[model samples]
Target: MTVRMTSARKAILEELESSKAHLTINQIHERLSGRLPSLNVSTVYRSLDFLSQNGLISISDMGVGTPVYEIMKEETHHHLVCSSCKQVIELENDLVAPFFEQIEKEKKTKVITNHLVVFGICLECKEY
Candidate 1:
């Protein structure tokens, strides 16, 4: 069954669903103003926390100290964070899967790992 959403919640969901990059609360607040002029920071955060708990979306720290959120459309993915620019890039799990499998085999480990995070400077920041 599909759950119905309140206007405030729907507004938040639309912003995330339409975006490609993960967005911090500030970004969301700004984007929402165009349509949801009555939106406030507290409501945005509260609804986000609820949605995250309900599996509607996922939140990750983009190394900017502010939590960024993305639409959870796919399996858990990894990220590349820029130290200088604070840029976030979403990447599929393929890059690190082989190495992780090798490690698990070497250690005779059967651990259930779901999420992986990788941090590094993006190419734009590297050129500086």
Candidate 2:
């Protein structure tokens, strides 16, 4: 289905693309409210829902209180979160691809880890 692009959707997409960190719906609304004053929280939520459903964006809970959203891209990536300090580390696909390959071979099943976030203590926190 072709989703017609609206101003609200455009603003949200722009915000998601520009942001380095994933953001929650309220955070997105807050960022775009100044530029698109007519945009409301409900509109942001709905547009995000539509975009996420269309695979244009991704929504995930990265061991945080609220779920966050980011634009989906061709290159797959994963996150390693420090449970103690709440620090997030981005992991390249190459690093975990081999592990997933072994798992698939052993289990005889395809692994879907699009939103995988492995939680653990970082080195510094672990040493402390």
Candidate 3:
């Protein structure tokens, strides 16, 4: 599906692309507010939803109360978020592919979501 790029969507996409860290809706709005005076939280939310639906961006919980958004990359990966320290560790797709394949075989359904977030205590947190 060809998504019509509006000014708001374009700005939001660019912001996500430029940011190395995941951003919440409010963060996206605040960062763009200076450049786009009319940009609102609602618009940012809608644009994020639209982009995510189109597979252009990914939304993950990352153990945070609010979901975070990042621009989709060619190399898909998941996250293991440390509940204690809030450290995020990247999990490669290869490690998850077999698990997803097993689920697909058993459920007879296609897994569409490429990105996943698992919450747990990291080694450091667990040790301490």
Candidate 4:
């Protein structure tokens, strides 16, 4: 299958690649509207959905009200979100590989995910 990379897709990809935090569709639209001037929320949403379906980007529901989007990376990592302060901590996939393996072995099903978001109270939040 062939995919045409539209201007909206290009702008959204750039925004995701440069961002440190996962952004919602609205956030991406808001960030690019000034530059594109004609970009709309529905276009951004469609582009994001297409990219995600093609595995070009990763999407997660970081327990926030909205689903967030990020560019796909070589090293897969998971987020350790502080339930109290909502601080996000990036953790290597290796830390949870064994758990996934165990689940697959016991359940006889393949486990697949680009990223994982786990919630917990951080030390700073706990101390507060």
**Which one wins on lDDT?**
3
lDDT of 4 by residue, 1-128 (tens): 67679999988988988985699888899999898989988888899999988888888988788999989888778889987889899888899788889999999989877778889999987886
Against the true structure, what is each candidate's TM-score? 0.69, 0.82, 0.95, 0.86
Candidate 4 TM-score to native? 0.86
Model 3: per-residue Cα lDDT over 37-70, one tens digit each: 9888998999999999999999988777999999
- Candidate 2 TM-score over all chains jointly: 0.82
TM-score: which is higher, 1 or 2?
Answer: 2
With a 3 Å backbone cut-off (N, CA, C), the pairs that clash in candidate 3 are none
lDDT of 1 by residue, 4-122 (tens): 68888888888899886678999999999889888899999998988787678778766778888887767767777677786667667787678678988999886344345468877
Clashes by residue pair, model 4: none
Candidate 3: stretches off by over 4 Å: none
Backbone clashes under 3 angstroms, per model: 0, 0, 0, 0
- For residue 95, give model 4's deviation from the true position in Å: 0.8
The alpha-carbon lDDT assigned to residue 2 of candidate 3 equals: 80
Residue 55 alpha-carbon offset, candidate 3, angstroms: 0.7
Q: Over 4 Å off in model 4, which ranges? A: 1-3
lDDT at residue 11 of model 4 (Cα atoms)? 88
lDDT of prediction 3: 0.90
The alpha-carbon deviation from the true structure for residue 88 of candidate 1, after best TM-score superposition, in angstroms, is 3.8
User: RMSD (Cα, Å) of candidate 2?
Assistant: 2.4
